[model samples]
Target: MTVNPLATPLSLPARPELTGGRPLGVLLLHGFSGSPASMKPWAHALAERGYAVEVPLLPGHGTRWQDLNKVAWTDWYAEADGALDRLRASTEAVVVGALSMGGSVALRLAEERGSDVAGLVLVNPFVSSTRTELKALPVLKRVVPSLKGVVNDIKKPGQDEVGYPRLPLRGLAAVLEMWQSVVPDLPKVTQPLLYFRSSVDHVIDPSSSPTVLGAVSSRDVEERILADSFHVATLDNDAPRIFEESAEFVARVTAS
Candidate 1:
């Protein structure tokens, strides 16, 4: 019996497209406080397109709350970077795809990888924000911990209600640290970039799109808008198009 690596205990409702053959190796990064489960479909699509997709569970993710509290930005980046490095070791060209905060890590990887990185596909990349709440008290971040395992009524996916109930303060601090580290280096990101923005994202500020558009030096940058989805567009109604466009972007960049 040939062991199918994609077959996890998640018993992910089999999407035929996910199985078949592999083409290019793609590193798929999920959003902050998100699990690799969200990127599963997109991975399947990319795999069906003959691409090998790697969706890594970032450190401090997909597990308990205290585990997340212990890790920092470097841990997350190292996990993502390790996945990319593994993909690069086996493939000629690697395309980095990320959602939200994951996009930040992916962009940083592209900048560091330079010519070796083929392109970038970013979904709702959180750049700078004018949101008064986050700016007002950066100190509040240190005091708060994730409310994930608490609030017994919280929905933990596959529930009737869908939303991220807990906001981890320490995690946000690490994210801010990462943003500060990456902002100055944004202009050096010359890899082809495809940025997808959600018009209705409540978690992300509307200003983020322009920040990314102006910051990234990618000569072939393209921006597309998702009208029906909120922050987690990858799992929303507009997901299929996002997957298609992303795969197409990678194909174009690698070919050129």
Candidate 2:
């Protein structure tokens, strides 16, 4: 059988739309080494429910992994922050949802934006890693260019996340930097939080969720365990739960 070209490791189109009904906007972020394809289903689910949604392709992402190494953590965060700004400008309130490293970026946005962000929905956010290799990232990033990839961690078959097949060391370093930067400010995220974690994940260490739950100052924080999914849970079996619960969370938080 012939393969679809878009299914290959190539840059995909960015997904962004403004649903003209609700004054509430949702900014959905995909994971590191991933494109908007991962978040597209969730974005559409929220949009159909009358919420404005923006799923931007992060800088240096959705393209070649080599390109990801050329950029820094700040670049990725800046892109997400800009998207949040545009969403906030059009809507009265904004809720940020992210997967993996995308969740780290969301927390950073919540910390910096303060009360501007209405709520947060995170799926297996990467905060810190216990990997011994990570300790050498600073030096390895300068010597090594890339390593084994950590993409397409979904358990569902015939599904594609359109992520890079190789992990760029510089990009990995940037992700580590983002984690370190966001960890300290976790307490600053006072917005309501909805965290979704897969029961079994090979990509991210399981310690991430507990660290977030313990650090965040949000009193309305809630956690849902994805019994049948992996790290990229957005494209897995429990996706509907994430989409529905996030929409409901946004409604409850943004209600005036």
Candidate 3:
């Protein structure tokens, strides 16, 4: 139930070309209750490798969880859509890399936008929520908007940090709704998918494993388990490996 609104809006750099032979474009999305700050290193690495990267700050995020109560899943999706459009304006094809809930958005975008997206990199995405967790959210959202600042303590990507301490219950509700909304459409995702699963993650449901692999229509599916990381694999001990695999995936997608 930890969901704190982002305090101040954060701005992400847009459409900077990698000074090589027209490197492909990459769009990155951070997880719920997270911000672009978490994905900066990954984006910078891609940028260094001659790939243009766009990591947008999701709406109601990077500011505060209270604002998140007013925002819906659509708002977050639109942000990612905007980032993808930015990538499209500069490159021939776009690759999407998303962490946690961000992964769901990336998959949905690929499903909806089709050939516009080249591939997907998913890190601990939430396709489904456990029943008990779902039932408790509404009460938590109302009784405790900021759950004692626990939500704020999450790990950020570029910083040695955990987010706010309170869990923004209303913010989490929106995320749960988003998960339910997108689960059915997973079969529509036809692009290549690279899943970076965290062996130690306790947040996402165990059901995610077979469901994701079975539902995705992608012909090229690669699943890598992070042996030493938690839910935030992008910033954990296995981060370097995640970067390498993601870079390789982007290269393959661009070449094809």
Cα lDDT of candidate 1 equals 0.71
lDDT (tens digit, per residue) of candidate 1 on 1-256 = 2212332212112222332322357788877766666678888887767676788777776654455567888888898888877777766677888888888888778878797678889988875678677763367756666544211121224321112347676776678788888888889899888988887776778776777779888899889998877777777778889999887887777763
lDDT of 3 by residue, 1-256 (tens): 3333332223333333543355478898887777776677787777667787887777877655577667888899998888788778867778999988788788789888999999999888877755685697777777777655423222334433234444567877887787776778888888999988877666666667677889888889988888777777777778788888898888888784
TM-score of 3: 0.86
Residue-level lDDT of model 2, residues 181-249, one tens digit each, is 899989999999999999999998888988899999999999999999999999998999888988889
Candidate 3 versus truth, CA RMSD in Å, comes to: 4.0
Off by over 4 Å in 3: 1-20, 148-162
Worst 10 residues of 1 by lDDT: 7-16
Q: Whole-model lDDT for model 2 versus the true structure?
A: 0.84
How many residue pairs clash in all the candidates, one count each? 3, 0, 24
Query: lDDT (CA) for every model shown?
Result: 0.71, 0.84, 0.74
In the order shown, the candidates' Cα RMSDs to the true structure are 5.8, 4.3, 4.0
| Model 1 residue-pair collision total | 3
Ranking by TM-score: 2, 3, 1
Which of the predicted structures, 1 or 3, would earn the higher TM-score when compared with the native? 3
Candidate 1 vs candidate 3, lDDT winner: 3
